[model samples]
Target: MSLVRVLVLEPSELDPVGPLGDWLRDAGAELEIVAPAEGPLPPLGDYDAVVCLGGEMSASDDAVHPWFADVRKLLAEAVSARKPVLGICLGAQLLALATGGQVRAGTRGPEVGPLLVAKRDVAAQDPLFADLPFTPDVMQFHSDEIHVLPPSAELLASSPRYPNQAFRVGACAYALQFHIETTPHVVARWCENSPESAAAARPGDVDDGRLRSVHEDIAETWKPFAERFVRLAARYAGSLPGDPPPPRSLPLV
Candidate 1:
């Protein structure tokens, strides 16, 4: 079996690989995390698959966060290469923008809690979302949304508030507006820091323990998704046995 190599891009301090990392490791895939905010991105040609995590920054804020432009370029390259790519939240917006889709401040306002997204009819044929429940539980904490998906993108899942929830571009690339990687602690930290959560707070203010309880559902639904992604990476890796191995450690420029 070929060794699956995955490049994970972390654009901020708060966004870390939680459960998804564990699932990847369990599937025997190696993960290298790159923090482009610190320095330059490594060559996009290195990995079999790429997973770009969510961040607080808007995808189009290149002036404020200059790395976004580079990130979008890399995403476009990955799509052109037909490499399997998964983008969560901000990363998803980046994928959309890189491929000619539009993104702007979310019209539905900030979505900062556990919720369900109804899988679209197209999801029935998707490798990642096909087996998912009709209304899969996912975590969301973003103020920006994909306003229009690329013409080549396939709509996979959605909610009433956000119609462009999940989509696929090219054959192996996917973009998810909601998060499937967050754990309860991750969600808790997000809630504590998010002004949106503060504004939505009631007197009791734990959101009915919905944040804590939904993690089990998240694990149940997304673990398989993550594993399948690693398998996709492994399959890609097989085609390049003699290619140079992935970087031993993340580039920390």
Candidate 2:
């Protein structure tokens, strides 16, 4: 079998580290994690699949982070090349932003725990999510969300607060608002430092217990999703084409 090359963009303390590295290694995908601003953004053409991990900074924070333009261009090029791309949290928001979808501060508020996710019809039938837990407890730690789905994009999953949790840009590209790649320990480490969650429990803030519970769910769900992503990577590493945009449905609960 040919090797699958993956590009992972990381810009936060909680971004995938040892655990996820092991996860992807076990899944047979060779990954190169790029911390864009910290280091240098590598050429996008060499990668078979591009994976953008979540970060504390919003993808829309162009004024503060000049590096965002490079990140945006990489995502756009990935889509243009029809390469399988995966985005999580800010990364997912980046995917939306790169593809003409609108992203804004989650007006519904911060989603910080196990959420009741509502899935679109396509999400239920998605091959990438065939093993996903139903209404499964998924980890959420963002204060922003995608407000619009780009043209021909498939709305996969959503929650009460954020209408778009998971979406597909094309046949091989996908974006998810939840952190399926995170582990309980990983979140604890970050939450332990995060001033907001570290100080004290604000009215509706998620405490350590709630955070751990959902993170466990995220770890469990990661295996399947990782497998699916790797599968897409392997396929795309071998071929590239603009596949037809699958039909989509906006399930308004």
Candidate 3:
């Protein structure tokens, strides 16, 4: 099989691809990590899949972060072309905003620390989420949230505080408001950099031991999910240009 080529966009220096990079590589993908601020973005056609990582910037702050405009355009183009895409945290908010949804400073305040988000009934039939536990562990650190999903999106998971924890915009595009790619050390650095967000969590929630345990739980649940994503990308990579796209309603498995 041809290697699946994936473009991993890093919108913030603080939020690199992290463990997700290892997961994609181990799953047989060739990845290119790009920071839009450093240079012009490559065309979406160059890769079979795209993964947009989280950032500190608000998704709609195009004026403050000019590179956001190009990033949103790439995400929109990737979805339109039916390329497999994964958007995490701010990436998720950007996906929502780029596709006719809304994003804003979360009314409930920052959602930080390790947490569990319940999978919706719809997720039971989702290609990537179906096999996950009823509630899966995830790391949260964003101050903004996706208030509305894209018109075509299917809600996949939710939390009591944030109902838009996860959603699928199309057959292969997924967005997650939580983080599955962070490690304990990464969380520590994030806490240090954004003490306000860290302070939002309960006193012990962001502690080293708790962060480590939660990351273990997250790895068990989401590593397979990441692998499944690579398989989806590989399927797309193997198709001839003129071939019919995968059925929109069927699970890739």
Estimate, for each residue in 1-253, the C-alpha lDDT of model 1 and write its tens digit.
Answer: 6667889999877889888889988887789999988888988788888999998788888889998888888888888777789999989999898888999998867776777899989899887888889999988788888999987689999888889999998777899999988877776777778866445533433354765678888898899998888777666566434432342321111
Give me the runs in candidate 1 sitting further than 4 Å from their true place. 201-208, 239-253
Question: TM-score of predicted model 1?
Answer: 0.89
lDDT tens digits by residue: candidate 3, 93-207? 8888778789989999999998889999999998799999999999999898888788878999999998999999866889999999998898899999988889999889998
Each candidate: how many clashes? 0, 0, 0
Query: For model 3, where is the 10-residue window of minimal lDDT?
Result: 244-253
Model with the higher lDDT, candidate 2 or 3: 3
lDDT of 2 by residue, 1-253 (tens): 4557888888676676545566777778888988888866888788888888888887788999888878888887788777788888889998888888899887866776556576677777787865676676667778787998877899888787778899998666799897777765666666666656333334433566776666666667776677777777776665324334433432211
Extract clashing residue pairs from model 3.
none
lDDT: worst 10-residue window of model 1: 244-253
Candidate 3 vs. truth: CA RMSD? 3.8
Which ten residues in a row are the worst by lDDT in model 2? 244-253
Cα-based TM-score, every candidate: 0.89, 0.85, 0.94
- lDDT of the candidates, in the order given: 0.82, 0.75, 0.87
Which order, best to worst by lDDT? 3, 1, 2
Q: Cα deviation of 32 in candidate 2 (Å)?
A: 0.7
Total clashes in model 2, counting residue pairs 3 or more apart in sequence or in different chains: 0
